[model samples]
Target: MRYFEFILILEIGILLLLSLFGKKLLNRRIVSAFVLVTLVAHYFLEGIRWQMYPTYLMAFFILLFYNHDFLRKRKWYIKTILIFCLLLLAVSGAVAKLVPVFDLPDTTSRYAVGTSNFTLEDSKRSNRKLNMKFWFPTSKIGSPDGVYSENPVQTLDGLFDMPGFVFGHLNRVETETYNNAEILNDSIKFPLVVYSHGAASSHLDNTGLLREIAGEGYVVLALDHDFSFSDYNLKKSDAMTLEYVAQKAFITDLIDKVVPNQVQDIEFILGNLPNSNYNLVDHINFEKIALMGHSLGGTTATDASFNVQGIQAIVNMDGPLNTASIEQLELPFLYMSSFSPDISDKSLEEKGLPDAMLYRRVKQWELENVYRLHDRNTIGFHWVRFRNAGHMDFTDVPFMLPIMKTDSYDEHKGHLLKSSVILDFIDIHLKNGKNYQKVKDQSLEWIK
Candidate 1:
């Protein structure tokens, strides 16, 4: 909770206690003014959020009762009113705690971050328009309020199958990047990192990490795939349920189409980026381009490195290699995997679990796929496991909602470690940086 938010809640709680206990320790007029001033301060300082509406209304009612001398009646109704006000205060505090206005972590780089959005159309595929967003190093200096998205509530509502207002607080969240700012005009061109988002995720989902990469002097480009939340095509119940693998043939066919098409989209973007009017376009060094993605997009990146030429390296953030076409990867590959519980049939039986056969099959396939891919790539394969991470940890979801994180997950440190490792990996391969040993996190380890 923010400073003034906590203070307001505490003041309301104290006021309710004093009123309910028949204590006249403070002047009624003074109490009224105090609450009023606090309310105004909270509104102006923290901005108005819907979670505090009840608290505001209750404060007004309290001042009205005090000013009208209704509290002097000493009747049972007075106690009831005070109790109700206390309940409202609790509600306000709880909601405020649940939906906080979060701030993005600081970008650990010398360069300031700038971002811009653009769109591209693929004529070969019925002119399907792909939305793209890019982040790059900027010489501009200023900490302007950053936006999560122009309309994240609607997209997140559909993606999570929740009411739009559930994420309305996100509208107030701030990031660390400036929009449409001038890109850094250094004489040297920056290496480009092409990013692909996961299924049911948008291109800007990893904005916090992408901004850090850009701040570290790389141009990062990410795209919204056809399966992205804005254009989500798959039914969550059918594809995300425990019975997923039961429809293996159906889902596999869909992914087979999705991965290749997304790869084509990446290639198309890279091919046209040089001709584009973006300020970063002239400063991008296409010869040292790297491919990176999360979940299914990670698989797409790995697949694209083989099909596309002049790719320097690949970073697959917890993406299972279920649908990767080639068995061997010759390029520098970073496979970051999230922690998953072992779901063996014996363990399931011992734990009295239901027979979710399809779920078990899907997990088995993923484990095998990762092992096979890692084992086959004898050269330049780096694997790291994030101990307490969920699939969405690699993105900004954990930073947004407390419920999205595991009980043991350290959101701040986890992201910092992720950014550090990714930077180290890309720097070594793409920038040809020194190979000195660096500090490593115990939760994250090199598997190969």
Candidate 2:
């Protein structure tokens, strides 16, 4: 919770307790003035969120009921009001805790991050429109006042499967990237990292991570694939639930086409980068390009690495290699999977069960990549798992919608591990950068 928000809520709770147990000690005029002051401070300082509306209403209720001698003297009326206030407080607190303001960790690099969006039309594929954002190293000094996402309404609806109005306050969330800031123009050419979001996700899903990478002297090109922005409503449902089954067949059919289309999108963007007018492209080191993505996007990166030439490295964050022929991938590859020992057949033995079937395939696909990495010829390959982490833990979805959380690992800590590990991997492979013996994390277990 934010500073003034916590203070306001706590003060109200104290007032409620005093009304019940110590009404003689309660100062009605002083309490009313303090509540009004706190409410103003919370509104101006922390910002008002819909989740706290009930609590805000409760403050007004206290002003109406507590200040009135007739209502206060009637014990039954007071008890009824207290019960209603308790319900309101519970609802408000729960919602507030569930969807708290998601402030991303600060960028830890010397360079300030700069981001800009571009629309690319693919001539070969029916003039398919693709949106991409460039997060690049910037020489600009001031902190960014820009909002984190461009399409918060779409993000809330598509990513979290929630009504846009519930989290409309997210539109006010600030980020660390300056919009269209001047690209760092030092003589050194920056390594390019093309990032792809998970299926049914936005390029801005991992905005925090992309900014962190850009701050570390890399040009991070985040792609908004044609399928992710399509009319498909991909609910964030658990694999074990009936909701997933209802959507499974449709998702399967669409995803088969989605992966190939995304690979084409990546290829098109990479092929056209040099010819493009974006200034950030001029600083890109074409020779040192890396493909990185989450979920199905990670699959696309691996697939693209095989089909497209000049990709120096690949990073797949907890994405299954379902569509990718990983055996053909020859570049430096990093596969990061969430810790899921229960994915094994022994642990989840219901082989024919619909939920288990999907789980099995995902686990099998991840295992295939892990097995390939263990091969003697597969050099520059790393497989690591975040302990007690879930699939969406790699993305920003969990921060905004905690209901999506499936594991106990801290999301903030997981991000730090991801940023540092990816930075070290790309540095070593793309920039011939530092060599870490192992990325030191208690939860991040290195498996070969």
**Which structure among the candidates has the greatest TM-score?**
1
TM-score of 2: 0.84
How many angstroms is residue 394 displaced in model 2 relative to the true structure, after the best TM-score fit?
A: 1.8
- Model 2 stretches with alpha carbons more than 4 Å out: 17-22, 63-66, 73-78, 123-127, 154-156, 226-255, 340-362, 403-408, 434-436
Scanning candidate 1 in windows of ten residues, the lowest lDDT window is 347-356
* Candidates in order: C-alpha RMSD to true structure: 3.8, 4.2
User: What do the candidate models score in CA lDDT, each in turn?
Assistant: 0.76, 0.75
Off by over 4 Å in 1: 71-82, 123-127, 154-159, 226-233, 243-254, 340-362, 434-439
Residue 363 lDDT in model 1? Answer: 52
| Tens-place lDDT digits, model 1, residues 334-395 | 88877544645564444333443554566566667678866686577778888667667888
What TM-scores do the predictions have? 0.86, 0.84
- Give the Å error, residue 45, model 2: 1.8
lDDT of residue 176 for candidate 1: 72
